[model samples]
Target chain A: MSSNLILLVSLLAGLLLGFFTKPAANRARLANRLLMATILVLIFMMGARLGLMPDLGERILAYGRAAIVITISALIFSIIAVRILVWLFMRKRGGEL
Target chain B: MMLLAIISCLLLGLGAAYIGLMPPEVAVFVNEAPFYCLCAMLFIVGYGMGQDKNTLRGLFKENAFVFLVPVGTIIGTLVGGLLAGLILPLGIRESMAVAGGFGWYTYSAVYLAEMHSADLGAIAFLSNVSREMLAIILIPAVVRFFGAYPAVSICGATSMDVTLPLLAHYAGSKIGAAAFLHGAVLSFVTPLLLPLLIGF
Candidate 1:
């Protein structure tokens, strides 16, 4: 299945469970702890993936110039676009949100 | 504390793997591990959504604005990268394709590798990875100054997973559904548009 599909299914399952359970405070806190543990494993795996990739040093040396420029530019412009779009959206809605 | 754990785990994982301390089976496990973790994360995300009707209501009322987030991200990312391209040796389309990853490095980098060259692929990988890191670090500041919507957009595809916890913490539950939808739409469109853009 697509990663997207997996995401939706998992989310739906969680929703059903959450809605049905009406989790108590302790249960909710436990869920948060579990989520944190999951997040740590995920981050570690991401790092492992990065570590396993080939030619990191060479690639960085070669692409470092363009990578830095493109990364920064993409962040700036995407933020700008979202800002402008949200601004226009709020204006159309008739006030600040 | 959460951020510290994330960064440290990442560093620790990198160190162990780089030093060949991670067992070979552990390498195989890594491939499958994150996918499952992602599923759990999304599940919790959904649970949070279900737990709050107000948040869902807010997302529904802002449906039009929700539509705009991805639109802005696409236009903004492309325009930003294209402008940045002026200084680099890459073609305009190449720049767009690279930034088009929206912090999804693996697929875009692989696609660019096949469509263009390994060099462009490497660039895509590096830039997208850097983009994710930057978004993760700056999201709180972005939300504080610019508002949550833009902060979410800065996360791009990562809003769905890696950077998601940040979105929830800083943006509050009201912004949850919208950010998830925004990330989902971008994640869907990226693979389709990126290759097409590279061809153009």
Candidate 2:
């Protein structure tokens, strides 16, 4: 199966299981802890993979710069758009200021 | 602290690889590890969402219009991605795909790596991680100054989890609820968007 399909399937399976089982709070917390550890391991593996890439230094530098640029732009634009939404919302509510 | 730990983990792995600490036999496992991790993470996230029972249902019920915030976030972030694409070396689609991550770094990184270039995937990871870190830092100030919507908007998908408490404490429970709704919607949609956009 495709990766995305795998993701969706796993997610739906988990959702169904959790919904039916209604695991205790402690179990949920343990699940969360396990998730965090898994995430860290994933990141570590990503780093290792990147490290093994050719021209590792240059790639990191370039990717880092692009990352910063993309992040800042996304943040600014999302804020602006939401601000407009807020303004429109207030106006639609008959200017309840 | 979580951010620091994530970074530390990344660095540690990089350092380990840099020094050839892992045997060649282990490289295969390390390479395949992210896919499993992504699946595990998604399952856990889905389970959490299932357990909550409120976020998806609440979106349609109370304050239904709050859904617009996420709409705004999606459009604005895509626009930003387009502009960034123009400014940067990446293609417009590539840039938008990266932006479509919406601060969910883990999935974005792994998905992009498998579907697209590993480099692009790495960029998605770094960019989304930075986005989350920036949101965490800016949220309180944004709430106090710009108001609640902007504060929540800054968090992207993370408003549902990583930054929800901060939004609640600073912006109040009402905005907190909106933030959760915003995040839940975004989280559901981002995976769909990333693949569609990155196809180019």
lDDT of each: 0.75, 0.84
Instruction: For candidate 1, list the clashing residue pairs, or say none.
Output: none
RMSD of each: 6.2, 2.1
By TM-score, how accurate is candidate 1? 0.63
Residues A25-96 of candidate 2 have per-residue lDDT tens digits of 997998899888988988888778777777788888999999999999999999889788888786676421
Candidate 1, superposed: residue stretches over 4 Å from native: A1-59, A92-97, B1-62
What does candidate 1's lDDT look like per residue over A24-87, in tens digits?
7787777878878876777676566556667656755758788878888888888888888877
Q: Positional deviation of B172 in candidate 2, in angstroms?
A: 2.0
lDDT of 1 by residue, B42-84 (tens): 6775575466545445666666678788898888888888987
Q: How high is the TM-score of chain A in each model? A: 0.62, 0.84
lDDT for B66 in candidate 1 is: 83
- Could you tell me which residue pairs clash in candidate 2? none
Candidate with best lDDT: 2
Could you tell me which 10 consecutive residues in candidate 1 chain B have the lowest summed lDDT? B106-115
